[model samples]
Target: MTSSAVDPVRLAGERRRIFLALFSALAIALHALEFLLPSPVPWFRLGFANIFALLALFLYDGRAAWSVNMVRIVVASLFLGTFFSPRFFLSLSGGILATLAMTTSRKLGCEKIGPVGVSVLGACGHSVGQLLCAWWLIVRHDGVWFLLPPLLLIALVTGIINGFVADALLQRLRRHPPFEDIADGAHSDV
Candidate 1:
């Protein structure tokens, strides 16, 4: 007979890593899917993958949410062959700002704020970040600034859609058996 002892901390870390990898993959898939869809403008994106970031923020901690988002952005860029390109930088900037905004808003405990509010904040941050990156790295034109109003309008509409979808997904996951463990683990970390 043989007995082996497993370190609880190590096991938890492994579990976290696995879960984060899965989240990143899901984000990447969503990102790719969004790319396959049609947009009004070349730079416009629905940011559907942000749902995973919201999930990480609401379920896990800010660090985990950041990890998921960064990994997703990097992997998605690599897969799409956009690594190190101007677009890649824009995406990275947007992801960083969105994650920061969402996490900070949650910490601030905004009045009557829910996932929807947080999502909208993140979306707005993302749009601004991308616009700044474009103006600095690509556009370098004063007229580019005019894009802000329209971009913000697009962000508002898409944010509402993303937030509602994320809320619905969260509710369903909470009831599902296989995903229930993930929901539980996420709460325990908080």
Candidate 2:
């Protein structure tokens, strides 16, 4: 094929891959940075890495969001030497639940709720998923239930903070050509 005659399918696939790589890198960096910080409580993460997943959900589609999330989880785990470990599974489950919740809310015409609301929902989902994972694998008792209220509160605060950050990022990105293209619905399949 001529250089100018790029296949549309191939072009779309390439774009998706490139975007996924970029998003994954951002997530991995954020995850690493967060890991370096000392937390007062064990198993407590600010979840800043998820902002990129949320960005993908809004900029692309559910598939793209999930792709970004999974790539981030796997690659970050590998980098941190946590791959296939219990911690890896916990992170994976929480990330999956959060991405699913946010993407589903977006796809269901919940735009009125905006990113903030979606983020809170995703945060709640993430907390619940992680708690469930802990309950099953570590706690193995009803005592784990006691952590829910506090965890949910933390999630809400972090979600709002992250949501504002994502919203700001999206506002600026929307002015750019690629994001504008997506906003114009040109990448409906994305």
Candidate 3:
């Protein structure tokens, strides 16, 4: 059989698996590194691991991105030994919400808005998830509504930073020869 006639299904599946594995590893590394960074707010994370999420969203389909995101959160929690804590559940809720929001946005043709917009939207969703969980499970305090402004401001700032970082990395990767080859299916594995 001619090389051009080779089955594309197998090749596509291989590429997807490779991409998933690479992004998963990157997410784990970022999550681990976040533990080393000193932060004043206990729940306030730099979201360094989100870079991988954004990358996966841009590179692969939404389903793939969401799957990778879920895996990342579960695996990271296990690695950090926080699998059964309130923080873990809060993280799970926020992560799932954020992923769904991003995936929906992408499906709605919002991908043209780029990484910054996507990150901003994801951050807002994440904050909402966290607030809902806190209100329902932890605080049960109506006064907690007062914290919205500050929390939103923080989310906006961090989201922009994360977005810019993801955008820059995506651009850089696009320019790399190896990534170009992968994109072109010249390399079977990501």
What TM-score fits each model? Answer: 0.85, 0.89, 0.85
lDDT of 3 at 13: 66
Instruction: Check candidate 2 and list the clashing pairs.
Output: none
- Summarize candidate 3's per-residue lDDT along 84-167 as a digit string, tens digits: 788888888878878877777766654366788888878877777777777778899977667767777777888899999988
- Candidate number with the higher TM-score (2 or 3): 2
Query: Best by TM-score, which number?
Result: 2
71 Cα displacement, candidate 1 (Å):
0.7
lDDT of 1 at 185: 28
Q: lDDT by residue for model 1 over 1-190, one digit each (tens)?
A: 1213766556556666777788889999999888778877977999889988887777666788899899989988999899999989999998998999988887676435677888999999999999889888997977887988998898898889988988887787668543444543234443
TM-score result, candidate 3: 0.85
Candidate 3, residue 72: the lDDT equals 88
Candidate 2: regions farther than 4 A off:
1-13, 184-187
lDDT of each: 0.81, 0.81, 0.75
Ranked by TM-score, top first = 2, 3, 1
Question: Scored by Cα lDDT, where does model 3 land?
Answer: 0.75
How much is 3 displaced in model 2, in angstroms? Answer: 12
Candidate 1 accuracy as TM-score: 0.85
- Candidate 2: residue 171 Cα off by (Å): 0.8
Question: How many backbone clashes can be found in candidate 1?
Answer: 0
**Model 3: which ten-residue window has the lowest total lDDT?**
181-190
